[model samples]
Target chain A: MQNLVDHTVEINKLLARYGVKFGIYKNQEFHEQLFPFDAIPRVITHEEYSELEKGLIQRVDALNAFLKDIYSEKKIVKDNVVPEDFIFASSGYLPQCEGIIPPKGIYSHISGIDLVQAKDKSWYILEDNLRIPSGASYPLIARELCRRAAPGTFKENNVVDNRNYHKLLKETMDYVNCGGISVIMTPGRYNAAYFEHSYLAERSGCVLAMYNDLFVEKNQLFYRDYKGENKKVGVIYRRISDEFLDPMSFNSESVIGVPNLMDVYRAGNVAIVNAPGNGIADDKGIYYFVPKMIKYYLNEEPILKNAPTYLPFYEEDRKYVLDNLEKLVIKDVAEAGGYGVVFGSDLSKEKLEDMKQLIINESRRFIAQEVIDFLDLDIMENGEPVPRKADLRAFVLSGKETKVWASGLTRFSRNPDSFVVNSSQGGGFKDTWVLSR
Target chain B: MGIISIEKANNLYWLGRYTERVFTTLRKFYRIFDSMIDFDDAEMVYSEYCQRLSIPNIYTSGQQFVDCYIFDPKNPDSLYHNMERAYDNAIVLRDELSSNVVSYIQLALDAIASAKGTAAPLFQLQQVVDYLFAFWGCVDDYVENEECRNIMKTGKYAERIDLYIRLQYHTKDIEKEFTKFVNRMKKTNMHCNLDKLAELTEIINTKKEFNTEYQEALNCLQGIVEVV
Candidate 1:
């Protein structure tokens, strides 16, 4: 294990040499920061992995069914499992995609479900990132570096190679490819996950294109080369947000979006990875009903459990949340990336009262969960070991078959007391290794 | 293998031009630096440099010119300014060129930033020159696509010709460099007008006075678009 730590240090240095960095904007200036890697990997046993595989597939399946149902049928809403107001009033529910059925009818094709182990050694779901989840490249590159640094370690231990992430990604894109070339569209290099975008494009054999490089012509997406040759683009794994996907459809003022991409997507001329309008399934309010969705759609009990969540939209749940305001963690449903998450204990008495009143006024906008006593992972701080909050983002890819990448991105909070492990919030990441037994 | 976008191609061509401009000007500045060591009044060389580069002479003193003309990011002809331009061009074109190419330019820019306070400026200047050479070498060895090579060569040759004219190199040297440049362009499949090539040859052979007949040479060059 000590040798493994030494190897990790060497691997991290090599990663820096390769310019493997995540870019962030601070005070309107772009800065590239190294994502810290921990020697300690989250090892999953084969039995555990098999169980997780089943759970993840079921979870994503339900999420995809939920998205399709919300967009088209409204059966889930009419059945009163999820409230109509929650579907209609939620910011993530895109009305533009009311009747649009994506290619192969799959939404949340690549779902990044955030999970954290409890102190009791049981896993609990944190949040679902159905839209443009990143961090897959970090572990994929880290594993390569680790293999180079500790060739003997991999030889000795039967660790499953996580390098197949790119292959899996390519297969997933190809499986859903409408007709032409696969393109990984980026907003630009200044984006937070630009490194992942470009690296994945290179590894997956997909052309990395920006908005200017791609355009809609004759209701088909095409990538324009420097020589002005337009190659038809079939599958586009765009890293941009849904609102910024097409200026004509969503944010009319957005210059980073293609002019008529949504029209093409509507025309079923191209396949979008994870599809558009997947945010409806990932909304914090919707997250509370995922376990129920698994039972409803898959007709099986959820293997993994969601953190005991309460949507304030329900009169009963709202009363419970208001009563236990100080014990619960209240989250604003529309916000993500560790934002709008407030620990009830962190607030003063006056603030708690204010929050209670706000939740009462805007009941549909908030969801509360009992803070799980999650296990803390030990990471090196200065020279000594310090316990820090860490969360795992397991990537689940659904194509012809649902598959979960063996490796995951384990993000840890740099601040000892902080629970937020988002890269935007001064957190670092470690490569997760699912051990083969 | 080549990830050439229209924006990236434009950036790469300009990057090649700016990097060459900095390298050639830095070498010329060394000569001015040698003259300044002996003479007290060194403002003439700085003014001449500014005039030759077709830039405004804003500096009132030798130190000011060194600060503004060599290191200022605001000055369009400054080494610091050109490096910034080179970085901007190289950053977007990383998918096309070798990754090392971008890193070398970044290292040179970093050296420039740190050397701003150093007493001996040539120490840093030498590093920049070495890095620029390595950048081109890396591009040649690592960049596999012929179109990318052609675009880079076009910028390199165009900038070299401009520099040769400004520095007033011998006609034989100019002819040799221009011929190599034209041959490289031809090898890389860049279309150039045969008439412009003939006119360039004539000008080099005749040693035509540039001040009086430079406009005619410029017009002849304008007729040939370096197909990127």
Candidate 2:
């Protein structure tokens, strides 16, 4: 609405007043910058959102099934649905997680599935973030501020209230809580998503904790209270990475990790939301198999489609990718936050040759996909509406039942020529308004 | 959410101390600055301030004193330094204090940073004090956890009394602050050394001896509350 658009500066000031920011490290020095908010929301019709909700629920359910299978039985891999190499060779695979079924049998408790709609109105998932997915808090808080900024805009729009994200998150945590208190663990204040970590904790009524504040005693995780008392912690929604989560289990040099936390988790004494080693399911190379996973796990056709993709690991797909190298997009499996994506059209000829050789040498590390002609959303530039490339990250929470949040974080590239819509890469975000109608 | 970690409680306490430190010292500096306008004893005024605070005489001139003491980030005794420390502590306690309460510290920090460029720097500095007041008010309104608020208030009163003694305030003023500080300490879950509190009380109640025995009172007050 124009009313919301007119108060862009005012909305941003309130965001600053609430210290809404993301941290970035450049040249080894940390700088916290405000995540710019665009007032023109990315609205979805009720019919379209209905379709998306079913597809997202189906997709996340399949992903959850795959994660459980990968960690325990490996039935999907054994049945030749997903390759053995994709399970073992992927960097996200942790041997320690094997045979350790998480509480409630849910792995990807909070999934941020990135999707982009084409010019033809068909949606394609960009990628799945199963491990420590962020940005939900950004849109969650933005919607609150937007409502405050333009009450009339919300009244006129009939937007579904997206403020229940924390409630959804808390329910997800509570469902898996073994017996005690729930806590949200952060690496520290310097993390890029620290604002979300602390903000979510505040909203969800969970104690925000650092590694030092938590310890394991008698295979039970406990939070050390100020009075030298210990309170049992049954659920930990950790924001730290898998490698830096438990020093004894994963990266031994991780000072940010709580020592022996994996022991506690493995004993079924505590629950770690989005169970560790989820990277294997969300791997870019494994993305090619999600549709098959939906079919394999749910026995249903995928409601949504993946971007036409080719895993260079396969000889047939490798040939197609090499022949159409310039026309496709290349993504490294190990990199995230929009760092390792290379549009074939953007690369020089010499660079293309180097990339082709690198892909040939390390076929398992890359996946190429046809560039989706995604729709460009309008963002106010100067005084006029200008079209910019944007992507939506829909949060799907897997508790007792899988549910798709109505609203999502719609991030847009600030640069006209760029397609990387990640906050770490200087992207601004808009609130995604799913119409109640 | 209600139960706080030891680290958060410490941060809350220090956040209180640092913000109150800036608020009290800056007001004291303003008084000293006011007296400097007609008198030619600017150096004398600053030197006495440094002696009272027991900080190194790092400033060479009155203008340098004003600039460094109020605005310098490098000077440990500077208002900017204390404000930064307050923010550093406040930033991590967002969950305990809530973002609305934490934003006040940020606003106060921003106010101090903006005051550096103004012609009437002292006038601009008043904004910092106003924001600090708002920070406390917001904390009271929004921070639902009682122990967190009590710990922070304890730190606030503790710093107030410490600074009052260092600046050689009137005994009656110190007595009023001491009573409030004891009240907050009692409300907190943190262990308070009752013996030390009693000793600090005895020294303060000896009204005529209070001024001469103030150093001992300061020592007693510092150890009265233990983090354990």
Candidate 3:
């Protein structure tokens, strides 16, 4: 541990040399900044990881079943387990993807489940990112560099190698691949997660393609080469959102989209990893019912717990939320990346009254939850250990069966007073060490 | 490996061009810097360099030229700008060239950023040249695709020839660099203007110096790549 702490600056220099950065758009200008790395690892004991492994697998499996059901039979809505308004009214819910089934009936091939451990060591799920979740490459490269910087740390500790993420990601892509080569499509190098897009493609041996390099011909996607030869693309792990995926189908002004891509995907000629319309399953308003979804789909109790969430659309919950607006954390269902989240205690009396009225006026657009007193992890700052709020984004990949990558991206707030740990919001990440023993 | 997209091919070719431009131009700047210490008209060397590259003379003096031409982020024709362009292409070609080889470009760019306003700017800038050398070495050792490497070298040799002729290098040096350029151009599937190549070859064979037809030779070299 001492050796690892001593080599933090050395590892950071290597990260910069490798260009492990993310792009951010502030004031309508693009800037590339490094996703800082902390040497104090978020270590999980084998016993704890085993439990987390089961819970994450079960939760992601239930979410997948929910996505499949929502797009097909509408069983959950008809059975009255999930409200129909929440499924159909979301901006994430796309009507264009109503009838088209993804290859292998798999909607989310990669799921990033964000969780936080409370002060008592109990873990709670904060959110589920089914569409396009990044940050796996951050820790994967960090662990590789860390092993070189402090070889004695791993030799002295029982750390599981987290480098097999690319291998597992490749297997997941290959499992649902139709026939031809796999491609990881990106908007451009200016996009936020471009480093991960190119890095994963290189590591997994998939071709990294831009929209201009791809075209739809005869309802099949083909990658065009300089020699004018076309290679069929069987599976595309696209990094763009669904609304910007096929310009002809969703957003006409989207220049980054491949024209008629949805036509090819709808024809069943190709597979799109984490298929379109997955927002129906991961909507924050629907998060209040994931426990019920676990029981409804898997016929088992949920292994993981949702951070006690409340939907204001319910009359009883609305009254309770109105009465307790000063204690709960209200989240806007339409926002992400640590935005649209406000703790009730942080608001003044007048603002709290305004929030209460906003909740009363727009009942379906908000979900309030009790603030989880999550435990803080110690990180090295100016050669001193200080506790900061942290969270784990555990990646669950579903190929033949759901499997959790033994490692996760443990992001923490660099600011000592903040709870938001998003990289865009000035957060740094640490290597998650899942023990082997 | 030969099957690359036209966009990627363009990036690879220009990546070679820009990286070589920074390298040779920096070496030339170092020589000019030494000459500036000995001569009264120190800034004349920069004006001559600007004329050679066909760019406008924007610097007021020799020291300003050294700072802006090498380190200024705003100068479009600066070495820093060319290095950034090299990185823009290299960042997307991770699969064609391994990450181990691509990282040297990143290191070189970072070296340029760190050298800004340093106490000993020459020492810091020298590290940029060293990293560029290391980048080329890593490309040779780590890049497995031969055609890709050749395409990059085609751009490299072509730019070297252009710079050499414009700076009135020896006819023998021009012939040596043009031969190397033709060796690479013959391997790629990209179309080159054979007429321009023939005219340049004739000029190298007959003319003793670039004192008469310098601009004409530069134009022929520029016409080698069909810029569609």
Candidate 4:
């Protein structure tokens, strides 16, 4: 472990050589920056991992069931477990996918659930990212470099191998494949996660394609080559957002989308991983209902608990949120990637009053939660160890079965005072190692 | 083997051209630097380079030429621009080549960025040359797929020939590089006309003045293009 700490500088230099970077846009200009890596590994015991694996599978299964039910029957909405307006009025509920079942009947196939352990040693689910989650690539590459930097570190401990993410991804694509080739469709190389898109394609033996490379001809998706050759694509793990996926069906102004891809998908000639409209389940407001969903769909109690959250959408909940506006963390339901998160204690008295009024006026737009006293991880800064806010994004893949990858991306805030650990927010990352018993 | 998209093919071809442009220009600039030690009238060489590459002359003096042509990213024909083009080409084709080969280009670009505006610019130039040589060597040794190797060799030979002609090297040197180029082309299954090679050989052996018979070399290039 001391050897691992000593070689941190060399490990980081090697990461730079491999171009392990993330892109962020500021004022409409794209800039690529390395996501800093901490030498310390977040160690998880095998027994704890087993418990987490069960909980993650239960949560993802419930989310998938919730999506299937929402798109097909609306039984949960009709039963009044959740408000009818919440489902129909969500900006994420796409009418285009109504009654259309994806191949293999799986939605949210690849889910990234963000979690944090509280001071009391209880893990709380922070958010769910069912819609094209990034950051899995960061840890995947980091582990490889770490092994090279400190080969003896693995011999000393029984850390489960986490490099099978690509293999697991390939199997997921294969399970849902209509019949032909699997392709990872990207908007272009300028996308923030373009490295992930291309790297996953190479590792999974899938074709990395751009919008121009794919075309919908005769109601089938085909990847066109330079020599006028076309290969039929059966499953496409598209990195672009749903709105920019098909120009004809969604955002008509989008040049990055295929014109008639939705029609091909509608015809059941291809499968789209984590099918479109999964954003409805990943909504921050909807996050408060996931534990209930696990019980409702799986007929089993949720093993992991969500942070004590209150949606101002309800009259009773709104009254409570308004009174405790100074103590809770107010989040805009539609925002993600560490944006639109406002800590109640960080706000001025006047701002808190204004937030209470806004929640009263438009209660559906906000969800307030009691901030969990999350445990801090130690990161080396200068020459000494400093504690920083960190959160884990555990990837749960639902192929024929839902299983959690042994490793998770543990991102820590570089700013000691800040709690946001999003890579887009200038945070650093560490590899989470689940020890094998 | 032939999985490259049309856009990538075009990129690969241009990447070949641009990388060759940088390599040949750097070699040519070394001679210009040597001439500058004796003659103060070395600015004309920059203008000649700009003309040969079909880029606009934006520099006014030798200092400006070094700044604009060697380091300027905005100038499409600058060495920085050529390296950027090469980086773009290599980025999309990573699966076709060894990962180490792509890393070399990335390292070269990083070296260029860090070395720009320094007093010792030629020190950085040496690093870029070394990286390009490593890139080719890695491709030859590590890249196993024959088609991938052929496409890269095609680009390399095509660019080398273009650079050799543009630099106006002596007939002896041109013949030597041209034979190496032809040999690589043949190995890659991209053969050229034997008649053109014979004609070039005749010109190299008989013609004493290289500048007077530039049209004959241009015709030989035209023949090679037809073969490709």
In model 2, where do residues sit more than 4 Å from their true spots? B208-213
Off by over 4 Å in 3: B1-3
lDDT of 2 by residue, A155-241 (tens): 987899999999999999999999999999999989999999999999999999999999999999999988777999999999999
> Candidate 2 falls in which docking quality class?
high
C-alpha positional error of residue A414 in candidate 2 after TM-score superposition, expressed in Å: 0.8
TM-score of each model, in listed order: 0.90, 0.97, 0.98, 0.93
**How big is the positional error of residue A225 in model 3, measured in Å on the Cα after superposition?**
0.5
Candidate 4 error regions (>4 Å): B117-119, B142-145, B172-228
True contacts kept of 3: 0.61
iRMSD values, candidates in order? 2.8, 1.0, 1.5, 2.6
- Candidate 3 residue-wise lDDT at A144: 95
Show pairs that collide, candidate 1. Answer: none
Against the native chain B, what TM-score does each candidate's chain B reach? Answer: 0.89, 0.97, 0.94, 0.82
lDDT score, residue A434, model 4?
98
Q: After superposition, how far is residue B164 of candidate 4 from its true place, in Å?
A: 1.5
- Against the hidden true structure, what lDDT does model 4 obtain? 0.83
Window of ten residues with lowest summed lDDT in model 1 chain A: A11-20
Provide C-alpha RMSD values for all models, in order.
3.1, 1.5, 1.3, 3.1
lDDT of each: 0.82, 0.92, 0.90, 0.83
Better of 1 and 2 by lDDT: 2
How close is chain A of candidate 2 to the true chain A, as a TM-score?
0.99
Q: CA shift at B227, candidate 2, in angstroms?
A: 1.7
